[model samples]
Target: MLVALIALITTVLYFVGGALLMQRLKLTAAGEPPGSRGLPRLFTLWGAAIVLHAFVLYAFLFGENADSLGVFTVVSLTAWVIAAFLFAWSFRHPIHVLGIVLLPFAGVTVALDMALSGVGPATPMDPSLRAHTLLALIAFSLFTIAAIQAAVLAIQTHMLQNHRPGGLIRALPPLSLMDTLLFHIIGWGFIFLTAALATGLFVLEDIFAQHLLQKVVFALIAWVMFAVLLFGRFQFGWRGRKAAHWTLAGFVWLFIAYIGSRMILARLLGV
Candidate 1:
């Protein structure tokens, strides 16, 4: 009952934050300068939501009978990390607009974890494996943010090209700034992904025996895709649509490598 209450409160806070952000964006679109009080309130609400969400995670992950890392739990953790990063980034960068999508998603994740009761297999992990998992989750969360940013960039580019650069485009940072932010996020994500893969190697005894071959292959493919994209950006000056497409494509493979493989193994193959 206590866990449920915490989850409920966290969910409400998340939705409230998202709604407030959306309204702020709308106000910006309508040429209204943001109220000085609004930003502080939004941050407070989001920070409170993140704290309560952490409590919910603790209850689910460390409470009695917590033997496995459930799918919903993993997703909730990812959402939590993403929200935290966004909150920190907002202090220096105008990326709080992302909360218009992410905060509500975090709310839904918390609710789902509560509703499903963390349903998953009982796979235990040692410290090394736990570290690997943590790195992977962080990398995935960063990629998730980059993917959203890329989508927004794609839309922003399209609107500008079509001479309809009003509304969301106005709400967003400038095109060059958005592009720079996306690559910055991708660069950090790529570094974490590299570390995750490296740590994964130490934790796995046999890839084939452990049924992690598919996961590894796809992850490496994603790594290569991002590597090429980064090289192209620095070496050949790739940006705009090309950069957005590559970001999305790389995230797809990374998604398949992590979430897709887990779902298949847990649900389809019962492995």
Candidate 2:
């Protein structure tokens, strides 16, 4: 019953989010205000969907008893809050393009939260450990979403650079601004990834034991890739195609660290 309920809400949010995004894209392409007639209503509806989705997961954690779900619940809540604030800020910064693109992705996450449910205390582990884990995961989540946005931005940037026309390219922000936003997001992500690794190490002793190693290794690899990317960007003036490729590579490692660790922890190691 709980699983189905959460899934239903998850699907609703995904569908609504897609509609809102498509509407926004259409408005932008038309050279009209992104906030057009009925658009505010759609945004408001999305807000409600977000709140509803959060509550459903919270219930899944508090009402039922699943540690893994609770871990996911806390992370999802954090993502919700961040996405909300970022979505609002996108108005001035225009970084919201990434946010809208990423919103529907959350639905996949929420569904996974339901599918991966197992028997345990909804609230798991010591408070300190929980805090570290959730913080790390949430940080990775934002950057992961941001990475996807950067990919789109890069494609848009490329098309404009080459004087290509049509498709979604016409609606995106200019190349310079996209590059600026890309760096901004990656810088923050690197910091968070570092802190996540540090805190994760502190939270768990013996890095090789249990699920720690996989998360740690992939996380470290992600951090290294970004570090190299940033270094190349600053030192060698690596921009455009190189930047996009490097960004995608870094995110690949991050995905493994995020979803991969969860699976190994939940299924393989039984952590």
Candidate 3:
């Protein structure tokens, strides 16, 4: 019951933060400066939400009868990290508008985690395994953010190409700025992903017997995609739609590698 209450409060805070961000975006579209009044309040609210979210995670992970390392729990953790990173980044960048999507998503994840009360793995995670999992989740979260940024960049590109850059597009940072941010996100995600893969090698004893072959293959493919994209960006100056497409493609493969594989194992194979 206490957990439920905390989750509810966290959800409300997230939605409220999202609403505030949307309003800020609207004001920007209306010619108001992006750093106008009320930003500090929004930041305060978001910080409070993140704190409550951490409490919720603590309750689930450390409370009596706690053993929840399930999919939803992993996802909730990812959301929390993303929110925390974005909260810090927003102070220096025009990226708070991303909260319009991220905040609501975080709220929903919190609610789902509370309602579902996910179960933990059958066996306990060893230290190396835990380290690998943490790195992998961080990588996944960063890539998720990059994918969302790429989607927004696509919209900005479309609007610009059609000469209809008004509304939400007007509230976004300049195209070059957005492009640079997207690649930066991808670069960091790629680094974490590489580290995750390296750690995974130490954790896995037999990939084929453990049914991790597909996951590893898919992850490697994603790594290659991002590597190629980054190489192209520096070697050939790739940006705009091409970069967006590559970012999305890499995210898809990574999604399949982790989340999709888990779902299949749990639901279909009953593993």
Candidate 4:
């Protein structure tokens, strides 16, 4: 009951904040500086809700002899971390545009986790594996954010290409700046994912088990895709639509490798 309440409150705050931010954006043209009169207070409310949401997760998802991860747990935790990252990044960057989409998604996922009582089954673990798991979750969260950013960049690019640069387009950072931020995020997420994969291969006892092998294969493929995209960016100056496409593709494969199977098994098969 408490968890449900927390989730509900968090979802409401996210929706309210996102809606207000969108309304503010609608008030200005494409290139004009955004108004920021109430954003600080809005952020304060968001931060409080996020902190509470994290606490709820700690209470329910972690405790003595509790170390299980489920499909919903993974998604909810990743969204929580992404929200934290966005909250921090907002101080240094104009990424509130992302919050407009990210917050509502986070809210819905959190609420979904509560609704399904999806506190995934507990698993006994080796201490060493914990670090790898943390790295994997962080990598996933970062890429998730990158994917959303890439989506926004793609939309902005398309609008500009066809000369529809009003509304949200004007609210976005310059196209080159958006591209720069996207690659920077991808670079960091790639490094973290590489580390996670390396640790998994070296540390896990049986990464090639039948149920797990497909995940590893997909992860390796996603890693290679990101590597190729990064290499191309530096070597051939890949940018604009091509970069956005690669970013989304890399994220899709990563999602498949990490969350897709669990979702199928848990939500679909009731396993």
Return the top candidate by TM-score.
Answer: 1
| Backbone clashes in model 4, listed as residue pairs | 30-170
* Tens-place lDDT digits, model 3, residues 124-224: 46678878988998899899889888989988999999998776887778999999999988999999999999998899999887878899999999999
Best first by TM-score, ranked: 1, 3, 4, 2
Q: Quote each prediction's TM-score.
A: 0.96, 0.82, 0.94, 0.92
lDDT winner, 1 or 3: 1
Residues 73-154, model 1: lDDT tens digits:
8889999999999999989988888888999999999999899864765456678888998999999999999999999999
Q: How much lDDT does candidate 2 score?
A: 0.68
lDDT of 4 at 258: 85
Quote the positional error of residue 96 for candidate 3 in Å. 1.0
lDDT of 4: 0.81
What are the clashing pairs of model 3?
none
Superposed by TM-score, candidate 3 places the C-alpha of residue 99 at a distance from the truth, in angstroms, of 1.3
Deviating ranges (above 4 Å) for candidate 3: 30-34, 65-68, 119-123
lDDT-based ranking, best first? 1, 3, 4, 2
Report every candidate's CA lDDT. 0.91, 0.68, 0.87, 0.81
Task: Enumerate residue pairs that collide in model 1.
Answer: none
Give me candidate 3's TM-score against the actual structure: 0.94
